[model samples]
Target chain A: MSEEIKEILEGLPFWEHLEKEERELLERESRKVFYPAGASVYSGARECLGEIFIQKGILRTYLLSDEGKEVSMYRLRQGDACVLTASCILPAITFDVEIEAQTDVEALLIPVGTLSKITKKNVYAENFVYKEAAKRFSDVVEALQQIMFLSLTQRVAAFLLDESAKNHSQLISVTHEELARQIGSAREAVSRILKQMAKKGYITLTRGEVKLENKEEMYKLLN
Target chain B: MSEEIKEILEGLPFWEHLEKEERELLERESRKVFYPAGASVYSGARECLGEIFIQKGILRTYLLSDEGKEVSMYRLRQGDACVLTASCILPAITFDVEIEAQTDVEALLIPVGTLSKITKKNVYAENFVYKEAAKRFSDVVEALQQIMFLSLTQRVAAFLLDESAKNHSQLISVTHEELARQIGSAREAVSRILKQMAKKGYITLTRGEVKLENKEEMYKLLN
Candidate 1:
């Protein structure tokens, strides 16, 4: 594999221990694709779904409820794989969720058929992919715990803290409605809470963005 | 390879396609252990916990809150595998939850070390373990979705429905307090709701039990 490709695989838990030849084979199989912000990668009724890896930028996985409410399942940042990894292994039907580029994004799109063929022929490939799935599953479990135990305000606070850790930014660039969808609440409820938090100097809200004014205070409120 | 062991493997997703020889080898490695009702398998303070598959009887997983409130995480009935598989692999300094047998139980306990060795030596074992983890993760995600989307009454109704499906019984052999713990609500609140439900002819409550009087009505109320 090229040095450039090797570096990318190094950070990925599954590919870290791959042999040079095996790494090269996988690199050969993978192809890069890009989508602009707000562009839909795949919708519920679309075909041509496959394994997608976030090479750069952010994306959100969401489903439309029967009532036309948007339910945000998760957000995938740079270097993270899509939440629907298992869907790639068993491609029997179209998925309900739509994968949209939250920002101008680049991804490695590996065809499901090609992936299955590689895994069948290579034990290393199968182990790597399954292990990656296991990690994703663990992450999903943690997300579940949060949704069950945390309130709407707490969930948003947790999200802010998580994003701050990732981007080191006090400011979070998301609208109240988007944040409400992520936390599984009404936009009015979110707006009301944000106003309260801002009044107490816990956060600063202006237009569509929010900035953490007192991290310690916000942390206390969350806990 | 014995036919008896091969038959048992067919019941589990992990060992589905194994050759007779491989099945026998796995059976040889597995050890059946027994625990009486109320026996603790592993406390939240323990480490290096292995996988426990309930061959018979039941087990309960729970965590105690700071205020000494015990929250029931899950109940593992006969044939249910311990869902906290990743904790063993990741090796936490202390266990995250306590597992206690709720009845005289027979279990197949697979040591983490032995499983690790098997995974390194055999492709089937590795795939099986990862697949099981993936399934458990999915269950956890579903639980999270329920917690986020369902109301308190809906959750209780859904829990009853889920229990009925599992046991084929309208009578769930658990207390209102226990139900509250699982649902993360107060015991008094659960009791009040049960009384209201009973008055509405949706359910019947007695000492240490709650029975569905009208499942269709309960389902309607849940919706």
Candidate 2:
């Protein structure tokens, strides 16, 4: 198991930066973790979950409001390393969010003790953390800008277009509830907007799926 | 000038992490900059403005949309160290923001080359970057939440109350335009809301100031 962890660690970008001894030490200490699809991966505040390096599948990170609105922050895909999940290690990260596996997953969790020692002693390891946090910082700002500047319909339109591009199909297999959860809107509100879009010939809504109709009109809504 | 720079550098939290030679090198390389109230501090994309440490006054970091809507991200107060400003060094911070001096400001700008060297060689210096980025990441999340869940009225009420507390008085001496800008609302929208608040006797809006008329009522609006 430890040898497998070492091989996985070597495949990561930070692998080249790790000193030989520290690399071996981290491989020995790090543990592999798995979460079934739709399972809660991390939640609550300041519970050092350790840094997670996603090897397979995706993790959706979102914030829950007092009224239970779920605002998706961003997703961590394969090969992504997350520092925000291990907020306990970094004292300044005071807030917490929910992370769930979007699919059956495989990942390595670098335990807190091992990572702490490396960050304390290894500038390269610490530099990796800074780089990851900096990357996510800009992403959060983009999310903030979207929420502040775009209308709900605009956001819905943009999300649909983005999904269509990624899936290489106009048909999006998402229910109203899932769409609401992903975009931080009420399900009823999402339904109402979808109906309006359907009436406008921008999309065709079927049970559990939405298909883009007039792609240009839907794209126009994004602006 | 370099001697003065050394004295100021000694007062910062990251000063002790520097080696003796790095300290002298940084002090000589660093420059002091000042901005008058409400001047744009940083703008554009992928430009390394260098790392800035605030010595006096405040900076408001904000995003501008295509239609010219300005959304305030967060503020950088005295003693704050910023990494997002120097996005060129950290490739992950791709989003650009307009930073404005909220007041008369004095700050230290560590040139990108010098900072790059220290962060490259010193774990502690790199640790400071990670910590600062994490702090701001949580703050950006909070700002996003406020925009997501809070209504325009609730946001206005909360902003007025926060400003009152900060100024240590019930009267917040800011114009409607300034209030709108601070909380990322339209000036006319802020006026309408303030009018509604005034009608409810929750607050009194005068020529260029807002006085908390009924503090309890104003606080209730936050919820």
Candidate 3:
């Protein structure tokens, strides 16, 4: 188990810069955990779930509104580390966001204090944390711009194109309800837009799936 | 002039953590620049301006849509450092947002390489950068939630209440167009909502200004 943990640490770019003592400290302190799909990993303002480094699968982070609406923020995939869940390091900020497993997942959890100690001693780890935070910050800003400036139809179209590229297919297997949650709109509104797109020959929609009928037309909607 | 710059640097929380040699290096390398109100500080994705530490006045960072609609992201005030403008350090991320002076501003510019070197060598500097980045990320996420889940009326009401608190008075001197931009809405839509709030006895509207008549009523709209 110790050898396995050391091997994983050695594979990470940031861990390469650490001294042998620091690497050994992290290997000894960090623990691996797993979650099934649909499991709640962390929630609320005060829970500090440590710094999570995803070893496999997907994690979805989102916000819940008083009206019971869910707005997807962003997702963490393999090799991505989430520092926001460890709010004890950021006492001035609140962590009201919820993190859930989108697939059966494995991750290494570094206790907040241990991560802080490693960062204090290792410049590479510190730089990695700042860069990741900045990247996530840019992602949130991009999402805000889309929500505020893009019309619902434009957003839906853009989302479809993005998902298609990620899946490497013209056909996307997502329900209208899931699509609506992804774009922070109502299911009825998403369904209406998809139906209109289908009528316009931009896409073809069926139960629990949508396929691009004309990729060129769909890309044009992005602008 | 050098003495004045040193005093400003000493006043900053991050500077205190630096070694004396690092502080002297910063004093020698940093340049102070001024921006008149309404002057553009930074724009476009290709321009990486370096780390900006605000010495005085306000800077508004916002996004511009293809149709020229403006959406306010956040603002930087005295003693605040903006890493968004220092995109060279975060090369994987794009800084497409525009930053403009909301008031006549004085700031210190540490060239990207210098700031990067300092952060790499100093644990305190790295921690400070990570903390600030995390805080800004949290701010962007909060704004995203508001735009996605809150109604325009509710947002306007919340904005009025927030402005009143910031100014420490019920009367806020801002044009409807400015308020509209702040909340990423149309001037006409903001005016209509303000008119409704005035009629409902929650606020009083005048040319270029708004007065909160019932703070309690405005707070109720937040829920």
Give the per-residue lDDT digits (tens) of candidate 1, residues A1-223. Answer: 4454446655565565556676666678667778999898877555546677787898887656445666566678877776363364632212355678888998777666666766666666665666665565555544555655667778888888887777789988889987888766788998998888899998898888899889998889666
lDDT of 1 at A79: 74
lDDT of 2 at B24: 81
Clashing pairs in 3: none
lDDT preference between candidates 1 and 3, better one: 3
In terms of docking quality, model 1 is acceptable
Superposition error at A187 for model 1 (Å): 2.6
Predicted candidate 3 versus true structure: per-residue lDDT over B106-201, tens digit per residue: 988887778888877886676666667666776667677777778999989878887788658999888999889888888999999999999999
Fnat (0 to 1) per candidate: 0.29, 0.85, 0.54
Best by TM-score: 3
Ranking by TM-score: 3, 2, 1
Which model scores highest in DockQ? 2
Candidate 2 lDDT by residue in tens digits, B1-223: 5565677678767778788999888877899989999787888553668788898988888888888889888888777887767766666767878788988999889888988988778767766776687788878888887777799999898888887776689988889998898888789999999999899888887899889989898888887
lDDT of 1 at B29: 70
lDDT of 1 by residue, B109-205 (tens): 6666666665666766676666555565555445554565566788888888888888899889878877887776788988888888889888888
Q: What is the lDDT of residue A104 in candidate 1?
A: 94
Give per-residue lDDT, candidate 2, residue B205: 79
Q: Give the TM-score of candidate 2.
A: 0.88
Q: Provide TM-scores for the models.
A: 0.81, 0.88, 0.90
